[model samples]
Target chain A: MADLATFDVQSMNRVDLVTVSGRIDSSNAGQFDEILKGIVGKGRNNIVLEMNGVSYMSSAGLRALVSTLRTCKRNRGDLRLAAPSERVVDVLKLAGLNSMFSSYPDSVAAVGSF
Target chain B: MSQVEAVFPARFAEIARICALVQLEAAAAGFDEKEQFRLQLACDEACTNIIEHAYGGENRGNIRVLIRQRDGSFLIQLHDTGRPFDPSNFELESSRQPSADLAELQEGGWGLHFMHSIMDEVRFDFDMDQGNTLTMIKVHP
Candidate 1:
């Protein structure tokens, strides 16, 4: 409904780099999903989420991440999580969803993985 | 010692405002950073459900939050009057670890689980005239 989270998507060679900051919750997960759709549309599947700036994420955000992973993998792309803040990491850990995605210590390493 | 309360329109835009108050109350209650985040997430999921399900994302009606610390426990209650849906009657499909199969990855059932998991106790009360009140309790044990 509002700008809960904002992210910049860029193409770095063959990788799609997504730098996201702010909170991701139920209210704006659809808008977040739309942003991801645009990236996948451009044929860059290996997406890296630099989540150091994300202050919080709810189950809705978790769902968005999972579905996005599904979409990317369906297209032979993958979503790599990089440098998730402690809070974000805890949420993922609590949900048991952390291991579902490949996590990197930083964007440099995440982007390098693809 | 004293009660803290806030009421705002049941709008998604007001979530940040509500969450800020939750953070303030949790900190004042002497909750640690992890407990604060758990309280915040529990509150967020509760409020989000009210906005999306109760209000049908229309952003109408009002939601009231009540917070207080009593006997070494933090109590938070969210009240809303959109529709009377009892959480106890609903199944918590995603309460356990999500499935490894990609097709079983879910989205909608997570709010209840988060509320149930992070809080030490969770309960719901509602009536035709009183609306719904979600009570979440976390005791420092």
Candidate 2:
């Protein structure tokens, strides 16, 4: 069974730190999009997505991430990624979207990038 | 050949159920973690394309995914009653790696790349009498 999806969201001075745990597949990608949308909707554009706890990411997840990235960028804000698991990195790389987001080794570095 | 098949309404929400079913098959086939992830991702990408493209914007349709183990390989076929997509157009560029600058990156298009990259074999077929079928094959490691 897939782990229940959860997002640990924090509001920081510069960015919204979203610590995503469990699998992000087609199953719950809609909810994931909504969370990101809600964050951006609240006028917080710069988002630091922590992916260390993300075990699986499907194309649906990528769509949510890219859509969120586009939304943030349109507002002159950016979305950075932090500590993606090997599988997450592989999916991002395979999709050629790895370079689209600023990625760091840790959350501190990622939050700093913003 | 051992096989199982299911049909789902073409809704974004159904993607989770489809993927979960795929994972079960992969696990029962004794696929390693990496292999299971690959299968799940590849199949998920194909289904997403159908939901987003063939049946875009609250359109109602049906998607059927079939998984079969034959010989030393796994075969996955996705059948959908949405728009007819020429799967050939989705072919991943043989030489394209994922290192391009983000500014140079495009938003969509990556799902097909990921599908082709992860699966050992991917093909598409369309028939007016039937529907669209996307075939993805992965060899047992």
Candidate 3:
């Protein structure tokens, strides 16, 4: 299995910002999870997942997000979502996860939420 | 046996693009939009599970995807050398149940359930001899 894709994490103020682009599926979902784990490990609890460029997501991707949220909650931090494409948003809604995390139209608003 | 194989790193961005390709191929092969969507969803779930669970948090393996038309259905097989867990043995909870809390409905545990729900048949075979294989079928409706 080759590296499926890459993700970038940035920090702004108290927010741990993550920008994920590429397919999040069985092949790379674990890597995505590990990226999130690294962020959580830094003790920066307020998270904003910026998905404006994410073209697709699978249940595995959703799982990574959920797991990250759980981790943040355990640390008394919060995870927020931003700028998911229509297709990505549909999956979240279909899985009934739209309301599980706070979603903003873009990263600025998402980061501002904290 | 004519087959097509797509190889990509263990990343989410590529999964989305490949899923679109798979959906297009399924539709061109005469699957209705609804059926195509179902196949796409199932494939996405399977592939995503492999990415997250198989490689154990790294993009360091291959997810070999094979698709063929057989009998009156499209047969899809995903081959991965990840962990040896079987998806077939897992009990899929219903998606229709209303949850008392939003956290209970978070997105992590639905990959197997979604694949099982959408595909006509889903099977998993773990072979130390050959690796892990997940085979699924979707028939034209």
Model number with the top DockQ: 2
lDDT of 3 by residue, A8-44 (tens): 8898889988988865666577789989988898898
Q: List TM-score per model, in order.
A: 0.94, 0.82, 0.66
When sorted by DockQ, best at the front, the candidate numbers are: 2, 1, 3
True contacts kept of each: 0.46, 0.68, 0.38
RMSD of each: 2.1, 3.1, 5.4
Q: Candidate 2 clashing pairs?
A: A27-B16
Docking quality (DockQ) for each candidate: 0.51, 0.55, 0.23
lDDT tens digits by residue: candidate 3, B86-128: 5444554433443546456554467676776677788888999
DockQ of 1: 0.51
lDDT of 1 by residue, B3-118 (tens): 88989898776777787888888888888888887888999888988888777874678899998888898888999887877564555442556677776776567778788888
Docking class of 1: medium
lDDT for position B14 in model 3 = 58
Task: For candidate 1, give the lDDT of residue A88.
Answer: 80
Better of 1 and 2 by lDDT: 2
